[model samples]
Target: MMRTIMAIVAAGLAAVAVQAAGPGFDPRALKAVAGPPNEVMVLGTPHLSGWPKDFDAKALGPLIDRLAAWKPQSIAVESLSGLQCDALRRAPFRYAETVETYCWDATPARQATGLDVPAATAEVERRLAAWPERPTASDRRHMAALFLAAEDQGSALVQWLRLDGADRHAGDGLDTVLVARLETLRQRRNEEFLIAAPLAARLGLERLEPMDDHSADRPYRNAEEEKAAGAAIMKAWDNAATARRKAADAALQSGIKTGAGVLALYRAYNAPEQAQTIYDSDFGAALKEPSPERFGRGYAGYWEVRNLRMAANIRDVFAAAPGQRMLVIVGASHKFYLQAYLDMMHDVRLVDTDAVLR
Candidate 1:
């Protein structure tokens, strides 16, 4: 009995020593050094900027506030980064065009800071590296303005990386510290413009992970062939799923400020069962033999490649910080695919959109 007790005590001491020597045990860890389980919430939002002129950004304020409450250490939006940056640099004009089309251009930022893309990028990188725990309103203002200056709004991300995921709230309206125009540009398509980007800017995060990838898309044999194939795919749609998706979006927007409605919307959007619905409804015609040359397969193939690459990009963010809370703001159509792929990652823990909404 004495020998057995000694063995047990020795084993306990050894276990404690191992933990003390190595990084502490994290329950969320799936592999060594992977860190704690990352809490991820993917919010599927509509293209609000593309909505009608009467689109109410104020109505979406409550949802943004509630999401900010999650205190996410990282936020990923459906924007392209890495190789895409190369493409944007090649076409600097689109940088501005993208802002005008997808986001409201913040001319005030240029006038206020007198910093263009290159200058702003350098300044932001410098400031963020030495950022204080409590940034001054000017620090926050310049950061916000920088979001407008990057070639593809990449400057905002540069700042986010430097701030170490701090929440930046610059105020509201003209009294607001960060230019609303710059803040809107961070919002991709209209999702970030009205919702995600504001949350990011307010939290003072350095940059958002650009998870949308499109390098997989390529032209078919000819433009004519591609058109015919597209026509066939569209013909198969019969507008059933498209119409439903649009209507659902409208309903979600109507009650976006309420939080519950939007939460339910995200819950349904990320549900596993939603996959078959997409295959049968949205891409039902898209993956069939629209042409003798396997056009449907072409369309489906590109989609598969795009989503796979995007999932990989999203997953890559976890390597740097495994214990982070990540919030992904993407199109409603992407939620199912993004969630499915993320669910496969060992270190990722997808927060129930429904629960978060509740």
Candidate 2:
């Protein structure tokens, strides 16, 4: 009986070993390497929640320098889409892409205490100088351009006026009028857009695509409807955001932990259901008419509908000029979905974030 039992156990172990060797395993070496031909490298970018806040040029300067060094052929970015694209395409004809310049504008924290411009620039320069890999000459030139553009006090003032919840002025000049302010803001935004745009273009990227359209005009027109929808969407968005934060908080609270950031990412990916719930809620209904959430949902849906459009775009560009690397500079949120969608295609390779960042 014992001999029979031992035979049964040995047979089970053999079966398990065979089962563990999944499809594509070699009989001799029992290993598999390449995937199908359409695979491409993808990475998730964390939103600079505090884009210019928490971290400054010091942090971003090095990171971007490293990314540029990798020499990706195409860089896809999360940026302007649809009508916004239409607007951007027309912008050059309307306004001059002027000579770039940089001026120091201290933050309220620093300005309140009267910090010198050079002092702030010094801090920025110090951090940038610390980058492990010396930036390529081109990348340095780009950074200098960005710093200059960001420092333009006139443009900076325009951006401040565009802030969503800022108080309205009582009797400001034409410069402060909403329309004028928006134009300035839009131009500034486009200039900032160029930071990633031309670089990706240089790499022979398939093409740059925006995540969604901007409906800045809609909210104010149908005041009643907009308010209703805005309220609803805001409520849903708030609740959903809260739930997400709670989940993230819970995960952090748990003693068993990996990287908090990674866990936050998983939570974001799994958020579609939560988003769906938001859509199903009153907020979704409100947004359907004149609310920005409608725009937001529509924006998100476009990417979903045109799934693998990036790879297709890349392929099209490659057809025109083959053998060039591609870079995509998309918002961080789209990275997870983009990566999964890209993985389904054949022969693409995803750059490992851990490998790249470390």
Best by lDDT: 1
Cα deviation at 353, candidate 1, in Å, is 0.5
RMSD of each: 13.7, 17.7
In candidate 1, stretches whose alpha carbon ends up further than 4 angstroms from where it belongs are 1-35, 88-127, 141-149, 152-189, 239-273
TM-score of each: 0.68, 0.39
lDDT of each: 0.63, 0.40
User: What TM-score does candidate 2 reach?
Assistant: 0.39
Candidate 1 structure, TM-score to reference: 0.68
Which of the numbered candidates is closest to the native, going by highest TM-score? 1
Q: Least accurate stretch of 10 residues (summed lDDT) in model 2?
A: 95-104
lDDT of 2: 0.40
Expressed as tens digits, the lDDT of each residue in 1-358 for candidate 1 is 9999999999999999888795455444453444477778887766565655654556566577778888887788776643354444455443534433333244455555676555655765687689888875546545655654543354353343334334444432123434343444444446644566567767767666668876654445567886887787777676666677667667756655544555555556666666676667766657754567666677777777878888788788887666889998887667777777777677777887765655
lDDT of 2 at 63: 41
Model 2 segments more than 4 A misplaced: 1-39, 46-50, 53-55, 80-221, 240-303, 306-315
